[model samples]
Target: MDPLHYRAFTTPSGGGNPAGVVLDASGMTDARMQEIAADLGYSETAFLDPGDGGHFRIRYFSPLAEVDFCGHATVASAVALADRDGAEGHYVFHANVGPIPVEVHSTERGYAATLRSVVPSVAPLDALAELLRVLGWERGDLAPDLPVGVAFAGLSHPVLWAASRARLADLAYDFAAMKDLMIAQGWGTVSLLHRASPDLIHARNAFAVGGVVEDPATGAAAAALGGFLRAHGLLPADGRFTVMQGEDMGQPCRIEVDASGDGGVRVSGTAAPIPVA
Candidate 1:
């Protein structure tokens, strides 16, 4: 199957996280999928097979291994489908985690997709000291207000809020150690963040566990962060916020997260087609 290239959380001209989307992967084997993902060299690639009643069976694979779920790739796949089909409807995706609903709409800029995550959760992180050491961060560097925890939307991420934006910007970390720790701990990413305002936040997700140094924009992590904020009473019961990521990488991704209901945060962003060779 020929893969459709799409960049999720992007601007008009294309600065976002690129992903490979195989919309009709009916008979593809797991080994082939892994090979394709590795060959593409994106953070992740999505393989989709049409399921009953407009639902799709989706699988996400990184260069190294298959992940339970991936938000940016999901967004990219949905938007690509919408471009091929039509926008203004919801697409059901059956993932390794659970059933996820992605709503697509034709916005002024382009096709935008919003995915409602599986029941989000937050819990205390166990090895905080070792995790911090891997990141070259100390306890003092953490934002005392936002407690360190493991947050899960579909995949688990260690949510660490930095005390200062500069600290977040300076994101030099030991990739090998972090990858080892993440594999052992079953963490998908280490989401380092800095809140600039009540409604705006800056984020950097280290994704060494997935054989990638970093993710430009992570919708799964964004949803998990929203859930963590609401669970800890850091934000209002109904809250909407923007996360700006990839600024340091010069790609510039924007993700909008809305935690309006009791469970499952909604993550939204626009996607653009990447020029394929």
Candidate 2:
């Protein structure tokens, strides 16, 4: 089947993160899925096998590896299903990360999806020096209050808060070495952020482990960040925030995070079809 392409977390003024969605991936082998994902070369691709109505078995792959979950791909896949089947669709997905509940609805921005993540956890980073060495960042460059931690919603992400927007924008690190470190640390992406306000944030992600330079809009990382914030007392249990990413990449994306309602963190985004060229 042909892959469906969509850019998730799009704003009217800016493009968003692109992902490939295979609505009918039943009976496909792991090798076949990896080949397809490598061919598509999107940051991530979602493959689904339909189960009961609104239920599916989903899998995520980067060019190089299969992952537990992918937030942007989930958003894109949800919208793709809605486009094919109809709006106000409720979906239950069983990915490698476990079960995820997603609901798609039409919004003023466009077709949007909300995915409530599994209960998350945050842990202190033990290899801070090695991490800094890989990122080429210094102790003084970090926000004193934010510190650093590894957060997990579905996958693990090392969260770093820059003291200023300037610091965040000047992101340059040893890619090959960073990839090695990320692999050793069992991390998906490194969530680098600068808090613009209590509810607004500027962000970037280094996804070396996924064989990518950066992720334009990382939904999974956004969810994990919300968990980290609430755990650290930076955000209330029911707080809401927006993460602005992909600005430097020219694919500006907006992600809404709700660390509210029960113990799960909810990540929401709008997805639009990517026209074939």
Candidate 3:
């Protein structure tokens, strides 16, 4: 299998979250795919099984295990497909989460892919105290406006809105403790965020559950964030915003979000191949 490394959500090669893309994983077993992902050491790697026409079956695997969905890897895979297939207009991906529709366009920035996630829903806050204690975060650290809640786009992520940007930047935490809580709660990641403006936000994600300290940029979390904002009436009915993540890790990623009045959210970003290893 030819594995390609690509970074999603940034124009520059050094920015965005790096993902390993296996363009063809037909003969590979699940164990082999898992081993490849673990060895690659990215938060997630996408395996694409080419199907008839432009449709494909995609699977996501983390170093520790396979996940239902992954946004950055999906973006990376779409760009990889475009690079090989001469920029197919749009492709349908059958993922573990559901049917994901991705459109690729050739821009000055290269292949920019936009994916419309499955209809998102906010999960109720049932165990906020347990989650807070596990992270060693005080209740005062949370933003009153944003609040704490669970949101799911493709995967479930607990949204913890920080009261200040400083708190969001200070992200050192007990990895083992967080991993325990996340695994027990079946959370993919903790979506830490600080609102800069009504339409702009700074975000960080702790992905201990995925066996990664943090994710540089997370598309699934971004979709969940948009859903959280709309579900809680934090953003306007027809709102659009941008999320800046991965800056603290020095690989800044920009994620554009659009929330329709009816309830769907769209996330868009640029993806490029990383330098060959």
Give the winner by TM-score: 2
lDDT of 2 by residue, 102-146 (tens): 999998877999999988999999978999999999999999977
Two-way lDDT contest, 2 vs 3, winner: 2
Give the distance in Å from residue 113's predicted Cα in candidate 3 to where it truly belongs. Answer: 0.4
- How far out, in Å, is residue 149 in model 1? 0.6
Candidate 1 lDDT tens digits, 79-168:
998888765668999999999999999888889999999999988899899999999998999998778899999989998999999999
lDDT of each: 0.91, 0.92, 0.87
What does each candidate score in C-alpha RMSD? 1.2, 1.1, 1.5
| Residue 139 local lDDT, model 3 | 93
- Show the colliding residue pairs in model 2: none
Q: Give TM per candidate.
A: 0.97, 0.98, 0.96
- Candidate 3: stretches off by over 4 Å: 11-14, 236-238
Worst 10 residues of 1 by lDDT: 229-238
True-structure RMSD for candidate 3: 1.5
Candidate with better TM-score, 1 vs 2? 2
lDDT of 3 by residue, 1-277 (tens): 8689999999454589999999889888999999999999999999989898778899999999999989999889999999988855788888998888999988888888888888889878787888777767899999886678899988889888889988888888888989998888888888888999988899999999889999999999998888888888887545889899999999999988887664456888999988884
For residue 277, model 1's alpha carbon misses the true position, in angstroms, by 2.5
